[model samples]
Target: MADPILSVRDLVTYFRPEEGVVRAVDGASFDLYPGGTLGIVGESGCGKSVTARSILRIVDRPGEVESGEILLRRDDGGIVDLAKIDPRRREMRAIRGGDIGYVFQEPMSSLSAFYTIGNQLMEAVRLHRAVTTKEARQRAVELLQLVGIPRPEQRVDAYSFELSGGLRQRVMIALALAAEPRILIADEPTTALDVTTQAQILDLIRRIQDERRLAVILITHDMGVIAEMADTVAVMYLGKVVESGPVDAIFHAPRHPYTQALLRSIPSVLAEPRSRLATIAGSIPHPYARPEGCPFHPRCARSIAGVCDRTVPVVTKLDERHEVRCVLYGRPAEAAE
Candidate 1:
């Protein structure tokens, strides 16, 4: 197997509002191999988006990558710690869109209404590649066509608001690929689109990922999308990844209580038509007032009385490809002691 193109270790990102510090991404770790898809699944406010932003050194104001190493393997065989680099530096700017492209969750807000789609896409091309305006425009049209946007010639000149939700999404994808980056981080790529459009967007991403052989980090709450597009899975809670492994292992043999609960909550085709879907109890705790030890313990059914609430659990390996962070999987000797 090829080595990971990107490796994140013990990533801790925090947002300091006036009230208090919010641990947006607390000690989350994962790796993305070249040309492989890594799915980060969790409910809203679980740091799925923050993790992606941290990697690109684009955490908004007040949010900082406090401690961690975002090791990115460069094309020259050297590795750079993105977290330590100055975000304003030209090198970091190049890496953000040149080495790794990001498709924001919402295309409406992300795309400027003032600029035409061609102008936006061409800007990316001109920024990343040494090309004239005419060349860039041609490249932008090709990208739009590649993403399945109808009438690439005319649509490129249209404003984002002029296109439908699905077409806008396709343009966003085209913009992300304008730089031809080796990695793509898509945060909730299909949020408000219809079911058919959502499937089409997912399929488009998968197709592009294959054609480009790009390493992809797909962040979303939809397990169905993860199951369909991801080879590896990372289940996050609050701000940490509680369980991670191959998609099959995660779906069939989930070890963590939180992971089990999330899988159970997914509506199944085999279930009775009107049956109420299983749901994880309780909402995600407030950012400033996160739970004490294990973030998921409050809602975890198998949480130990004294153990889970007080003692934070470190990640334990269940196998070469599977790891879980939960007291329920503690070593037998450690439990006995």
Candidate 2:
């Protein structure tokens, strides 16, 4: 395997409000290698988006990355901890768009309504590359074409509202790629699109990854998307990864109760017609009132009585590359000792 382009270690992002501290992302960790896709899947508010924002140092006001390291391998063969950098510094700003590009979920809100798509793209290009306006405009057109927008010359001058939802998404992707980033963090890239458009967008992302050999961190709640795009999978719940392994391992042999329930919830084509999909019991606990010990224990069917409720289960290695944070996998080994 190639060296990891980005590595997140024991990340802890928190929001401190009048109510109390909300641990949005607690001890999340993962690695993204060159040309590889790492899928982060979980329910909403499970810290998937927070994890991505933390990497770019864009965890909005009132929320901050409280601990851990976000290491990015530079072109000069040196590694820098992004978490330690001052977010207001020019270097950090350069790193945001130059090294790591972000494709947000909503294009309409993310793209400026006042500016033409061409202008937005050119602004991003000029920010990272010292280019004349004419050159930036040319580059912007090229990007628009690259992302499969039709008649780039005409569409480039159109405002965000002028394009359809699918087109807007493609423009957002082009904007993110304008700087030629090493990593692309796409949060729910196919959120609101129809099935046909979703497939097209996913195909486009796959093609781009193959062509550019870019490392991608794709954050989504869709398991089907994960199976289609991810080489490795990380299943998050209550801000922590309950399972991590190869995509096949996760889909075929999920270990964590949360992971199992998630897979079960995905409707299968072979299932009895008109059958309802299985659902995991209980809602995600409120951040301020998080359950003690294992966060998923309250809803976990395989949870041990005294052991799971009283003590936090450490990550247990299931295989060479597979791991699960559950007592069901950990208790037997301890009992044998």
Candidate 3:
């Protein structure tokens, strides 16, 4: 494969609360190649969303990216570490929409109620491109049409609340593409939508990706969605990625216990009617009370008592593209001793 468009390495994001520090994203790493989709899958609070926010430097208050290297390949054949840039700087602002677009989980909250949809999109257009108001409006309308919004010219003037859930999501997607970014970060893009609308939105994203050849980082808990959209898969447990590989390898032969449990929990179409679904043994450990050796030892069925709880497991490569963080693949004698 060609050089990756974006690379995240040893990312650690923490939130300081009254209780203690919450390590939302701990040492999570992945690479997104140009025109390829990387899916980050895990249950809630596993730091999938925080990983996206860390790349964009948009983590909310009290939360800070403690350490990470978010290396982005620039158009000029240079690499820039987005993690080092100040979030409030003009350069960062420009890069947010111009170089890397974001489609947030909730459109209603993401879109301002006070501004018209066209107005907001036009502002984004004008901010990135030095165009006149007329040109910006035209661009906004064009984007709305591009996202399959019906009668975009008229719909551009509509408020977010005036549009249905699917339409509102379309508008959000349009806004994300306002600057023609090289990479798109979608954090739970199909949340709160009906199954049909979710499928439509997913299809829209896939079509747009193929048409534009944009690198995408899709974050979701749904393995089915991951199967449908991702070329590579990263399975996160707590704030760390326990396994990462091609989507087929992760689905058909998951290495990590958590990944196996997650796949087992998904409902299968070929299963007998009304059969009980499989589930993980326990929930994710609390951030403050994180386990000593491995974060997943508490819930993992294959955890070795002294070995799993004694030393942290380093990543072990099963193949050129597949890796897992578990003692089972590590130095067994050392772990056992």
Models 1 onward score TM values of: 0.97, 0.97, 0.97
Report the C-alpha lDDT of model 3 over 1-337, residue by residue, as the tens digit.
8999999999999999888999999999999999999999999999999999999899998899999899999988899998899999998899999999999899768899898999999999998999999999999999999999999989989999899888898999999999999999999999878899999999999999999999999999999999999999999988899999999999999989999999999998998898898999878787899898888888888998987887888889999999999988877444655
Query: Candidate 1, after superposition: displacement of residue 36 in Å?
Result: 0.3
Worst lDDT 10-window in candidate 3: 328-337
Q: Model 2, which residues run further than 4 Å from truth?
A: 331-337
In angstroms, give how far residue 54 of model 1 lies from its true place. 0.7
**Model 3 ranges with Cα > 4 A deviation:** 332-337
Q: Residue 296 CA error for candidate 1 (Å)?
A: 1.0
**Which structure among the candidates has the greatest lDDT?**
3
Computed on alpha carbons, the lDDT of every model, listed in order, comes to: 0.91, 0.91, 0.92
Q: Can you write out model 1's per-residue Cα lDDT over 4-33, one digit (the tens) per residue?
A: 999999999999989899999999999999
Pairs in clash, predicted candidate 3: none
Q: With candidate 2 superimposed using the best TM-score fit, by how many Å does residue 228's alpha carbon deviate from the native?
A: 0.5
lDDT of 3 at 66: 92
